[model samples]
Target chain A: MKQKTITQSLSWLHTWSGLLFGWVLFAIFLTGTLAVFDKEIDNWLRPEIPAHSLDSREAAQTALDYLQARHPHARTWNIGLPNERAPTLSVSTGEQRRGGGQALDPETGELLQVRETAGGGFFFRFHFTLNLPRLLGIWVVGLAAMAMLAALVSGIVIHKKFFKEFFTFRPAKGQRSWLDAHNATGVLVLPFHLMITYTGLVIFYLIYMPAASDALFGGDREALNRALRGMPEQHAGQGRQPPQEVAGPAPLTALPPLLAEAERVLGPLASLSIHNPGRGDARIEVRPLLGNRIELTKGQSMVFDGVTGKVLRAPAESRPSLLTQRVLAGMHFAQFGGYPMRWLYFVCGLASCAMIATGLVLFTVKRRRRHDGEGALGAALYTGAERINVSVVAGLALACVGLLWANRLLPFELAQRGGWEVRVFFLIWLATLLHACLRPWLRAWQEQLGLTAALCLGLPLLNVVTVNRGDYIPLEVTILVIGGLLAACAWKIGQPAPERALRVRTEVN
Target chain B: MGLAIATGLWLAYSGMIALCLGLERHYKQVWGRPPSSSRRRALRATGWLALAASFAASVAAWGWAMGPIGGLGLVSLAGLALVLVLPYQPRLAIGTAVAGWPVLALATLAG
Candidate 1:
């Protein structure tokens, strides 16, 4: 095949494959970006969910009592402790109402101040769901993940100058500039590209390649879960069972002391779990899972029998799968944690988005000179694509920022507040896309971009309109991000040289 | 069915403009000679509108031609499909598949 054919073939591969999975990847990027401060966002959303004053054990005791009393037959329970991002102590007694789950006051047995607490879980779930049907979303996202992995690896192989131009970024070259941006972003954050993609696959590995089980353990979900989770059931009945109910109000140890002791022994407990706290079978599990700060992607969990107050079994950390799963999880979630690593992942994540955006631009840029070499028809197509690229890229930014604006501005009493917020997002994007397509290339580019810039630049001022989160909420971070994005957009459309380089060259000729 | 519905909706939503543009898109793909006549321009416009409308009609008739996943879902999968059919891949087919499908689907989901 000719060099051009090969490039064309890659182009075809690049174009169709990219459009297919672009949206899902976009969601992942969007959500994952928000997930960086998932906890903080959760707190911002749920103002009423109270902080836990009592220790994990105290909260555990109240939550346990609620669970045992309300959902004695629940199959499983999950307790998430308060963190820097979220102050609420939460308990899910059962999957269903019958199974009984509620967030309880850490000190009092009273019901938690619940107010539609979707919190960061919304973004977490949106990562997988893409707002599609449940498991379907997973499979779809999983497939896209594979595409990303392929794109990363193949992109490197196909580019002979991958190493030669590793640091090359020339802004005035139009399409060359987009190519540089794509290549630079892709190459510079290649580790992130690889880590995020591979890890993302692992994060949803069970769904993506359920065969990991077949290949390793013969396709058994239980076997896989047990193997990955490290033989949880085996240790369950090693000790004697406590009574079905609390044996006459046993005045257990105060939670604060237990928490202090647990912190002392386990080292500032990362996550706390409560199991059957009031029932004789009640237990409090203190999780010393390594956070993003430290490095424990494969978590280490310690179970404390609630009634006995004895650390039942201290299973020294066991083996975790090093195969794609562990390593991928570590890389994807930055689970082997730390602030520095988190920031690193965050930067890489943003770069990954930049890489995609650049690729889109490059697709148009390479074909850009066709106006002169190719003719008016070529220029027209170029103009059309340019409008689209602008719409999709900057349009998406506008929608995102608009959503934040809606969150602040939408009156709490507004019926369908959540739905309306979502609707507003789509409506704005649709309108922008339409507006972009209607204008001529240059005008559309500048105007749509200008609109995007205006929205972003005005965000900080918009926040100031409400005394709620916008006014009282921290502005420095929001201001910087919004300002930075607006500046970048402005530079892209407003900068004159890249678009005019060819014209000047033609004139010189 | 989901994909079909989505495709139909997209066409319903943005098809006319995209198709008219896409018509020029197809025309621009021709090698050597550039199309210049008024007749050719009208023909291209009509041709593209037909194609876009047919696609929308197909989805409308088929209810989910894009598969259960939806039309946008097909976008990423189409990338994989093209790779499968394309000859002389630079092994970057894998990378294209890797980066394209998910990125496409992710953006679709956001929409």
Candidate 2:
């Protein structure tokens, strides 16, 4: 065998690593992009919550009255205050309920009987976990992320004309076009690709790489956390102590005033947790809504004596190292810079998806031309890769949009409706894989993409007919744009191959 | 804030156009002729200046902490938009950046 150059080895590494993890990364990127607007999607899925603007103080008061009337003796009362993005007050007692407690109308304290659907949280959770069991999925995703990092570095090393071909893209030339697109998107958005991949790993740093924590703290993450936060071990331990007998039960201090004070210090408050709601020793912890800054203040909160309404401790200033990690994780979370920043992240995320998709396509397009010289196994592998690419890429798009259709069409009172929606999503995805396996290659690509376009384009009509809500305008408009793009793709895929085009031209001449 | 964001995005796009056109090949691709060394030098300098100004504008729009982060995003997208458009409609790509300035100025002055 000829001695392979370093570039050739790296090129092999990039192609194989990219192919192996590319599907997972594509799924991760697509859903992560959708999760950028998770809150909006959450709203669209749950149209029962009427849109309203109200004072945070006022909203907290309503939640307080509702909780006081119903769960006065509950150990802890957690209230999720309404904001512009999520305009529904919610209340839970003791432990936090999944799906963010029960939705309460912000205007009135009436409990809204919203349909039980997965909401946009499905995308957010699936983005990282791929609907696998939490730990396994996270580990799988982490492995994929590491592979992506390796691939990106290897890709940079192998590309010969990195700077020379900075703005080069020549379309409609088949393999050359695909390679140009792959290079263009990958190089142009290189910073975002690297940042997103690196930061995504960092978000689960301790979970993925427990070596440092394991060595220093004997794998006691809570202890490590307390040390990082500069917490007195005893004081931090007290915060986690289960509800115990405190001073004789007393009337809770007025919450609106406390909310106002907390908001002043912490910016807009997301939720308030009143520990021992009716007791003299009650402590109220108010957490600031994220997006006030680039650093994710995830667990940062102001603690107040619930009876006296006096500040017990201001949100602890993050020790410097923790702040650095939080800021990096914050970039991945994208909870800063308001809507414009979110939009930029969304667009960059889509570009990242394009880069990966183009790379996958380019692999198949390159291999297709050389299949004649291949052994049976090689040909089989090539065919397998081609089918897998179609199913994973186009099929995922179909499933994602199919999820919205499920959320709308499923009967509101159906038992396990959310689970059914998820099942529907998977079913659509599986069906596309079967379709890809059965249909001819070109036909399969055209049909699946065309169906995804139809679903995406018809989403507004589906929404109008089923839910009849205008609140999904932004989500619907975005889907329409994606639909238009996919429609164009389907049309392109339906066209005759280049060799056929050449033959027709010769015939005409 | 809206004007600031618009101006910042326009400046970033114009800056990317300048940097792209600073290269002899891209300069020839659009203008159909190679530029003199001095002209290329001027274009490169102007590109860097516009990018710096775009950073300042991003700061104005998103505040000090987020400006640098958001500014990078703006510049990246501006380059992406430029590259995609350059191959198909090179003059139109540069023209939009040129035309944006007066419209932005009018919007700024109206405020």
Candidate 3:
């Protein structure tokens, strides 16, 4: 009896927790899944930047020269070498700016004329930030992740037949089928779900659980960061002396030799940062591009004296705790994986989204069979829940595809074009919510899903008419095919039920 | 390489589904009668062996860490596939498991 009560309480906890944040969680999961291909999506969105190949050393040199001319006295010069994934030389000086910094064509070192669009970056940022104020958004997402972890735990506690029903599925049985699917997907990918949620929390641990760091570092966040990143401990009076005067500008050491040496030791170079360039105190740091290694940290880097090209500091050997934390972060961000692994993550993510959606539907389906028409309040609540279900599940999908259409249809030279694209996304999403409240639940589902299908299927045609870029033709066609299939499914769903058909037939007779 | 890995995944996944179906309770639920004891034993043994072989194949294709992760996803997909097929064509589901192993073996050897 005690065990039964515990299980019942856990079940209640799971259901309520899941329902409270299901919509936001769904959006986060879907967007995060898409973000796995962020670079590819970025390529598709900006068609102006033609693809080109350039040597890493040459690209670095080009970026440095451009930065020298543009911001000669800037405190820091950070040059990102072009690679296979992102084929543009990116340079940022001084403080980091909002969105992306200036990008240059590797071949000519000229500023790129790429169209302004958020592309997949919007989804990636929205997954955690939700377009809200940075601190608030992180806190809210952290809370949701915590709730998800609690729900997963409580759900496992409540489920008695874990293994016996591992592969169970009873389709067409309404609530039973939903429960089975929820269980199957949840249990099958439980490890992934847990890892993602926990690591998501860990990524923002200093913000979420700052007590330990605060106490340890005496409320110094920078110190805490240095400790976490395993930077060399600072000593008093290390650089307290006045800046040394030099005749005109110091002749800087050649970067190509340093680049070649770093590449030989650390694989392909991703980025190089020169601090206090053209000065005796100047330091150069080179970071390698991330590869398919299981390690969380990208390969080791080398810091060189900017003037003499002498080795200053090699990459710090990460402590075990830091390495573990990095691994967790890497798993969540999927920085150490290839295309195949990314595809696998995408599929698993979709399955998780399906699991959540089915669970939400099951809640209403189970209740409608019992207390649906019991009273005025019960009926009103049922209607509201049904509306929310249709809007959140199908409507969000419609809004996403609509955003893509806005990207294609919007005038290229329009001011704040990227901002307008985001606005169109929210506008469509809000419209769906309003429509869901006004229309019958069944009609809302059918209309929204049908619209989603039409928009998705029409995207490629719109592309042909407008941008006509051959780079993303195959991907666009795939989206069109998926949209068409979804449309067919929606049409099938919109058909009258067998019982309704029989009633209509009898009335006609 | 992609094809070979995908084939191995399918073999592992189908094998897992067959193992689940080998249980007498599940068999009874599906066919409305319990399978014979000897047939049940055979099914169970074959199911376990096939699953082991699939794991080996997966590991051979991908490394240990990724192989298990990929296997988990593939198994869930196979379970879903089984759910969709069993209600309409139970025999075909069984046949998939029976035929998957040999094809997987051939592909592994060729690769």
Q: DockQ for each candidate?
A: 0.01, 0.75, 0.41
- Tell me the spans in candidate 3 whose CA falls farther than 4 Å from its real position: A1-4, A68-75, A96-99, A234-257, A276-282, A298-301, A372-374, A499-509, B1-4, B25-33, B45-67, B88-111
| Cα TM-score per model | 0.66, 0.96, 0.88
What C-alpha lDDT values do all the predictions have?
Answer: 0.56, 0.89, 0.76
Please say which candidate is ahead in DockQ: 1 or 3.
3
TM-score of chain B of each: 0.28, 0.97, 0.70
What is the model-wide C-alpha lDDT for candidate 1?
0.56
Estimate, for each residue in A99-194, the C-alpha lDDT of model 2 and write its tens digit.
568988888888988989998999999999999999999999999999999999999999999988888888778888999999999998898999
Segments in model 1 whose C-alpha atoms lie over 4 Å from true places: A1-12, A15-24, A47-79, A91-118, A212-220, A230-249, A264-277, A288-300, A320-324, A371-388, A414-416, A441-449, A469-475, A495-509, B1-111
What C-alpha RMSD does candidate 3 show over the true interface residues after superposing them?
Answer: 2.4
Any idea what lDDT model 3 has?
A: 0.76
Clashes per model (N, Cα, C within 3 A): 45, 0, 0
Q: Which scores better on lDDT, 1 or 2?
A: 2
Ranking by TM-score: 2, 3, 1
Two-way TM-score contest, 1 vs 3, winner: 3
Best by DockQ: 2
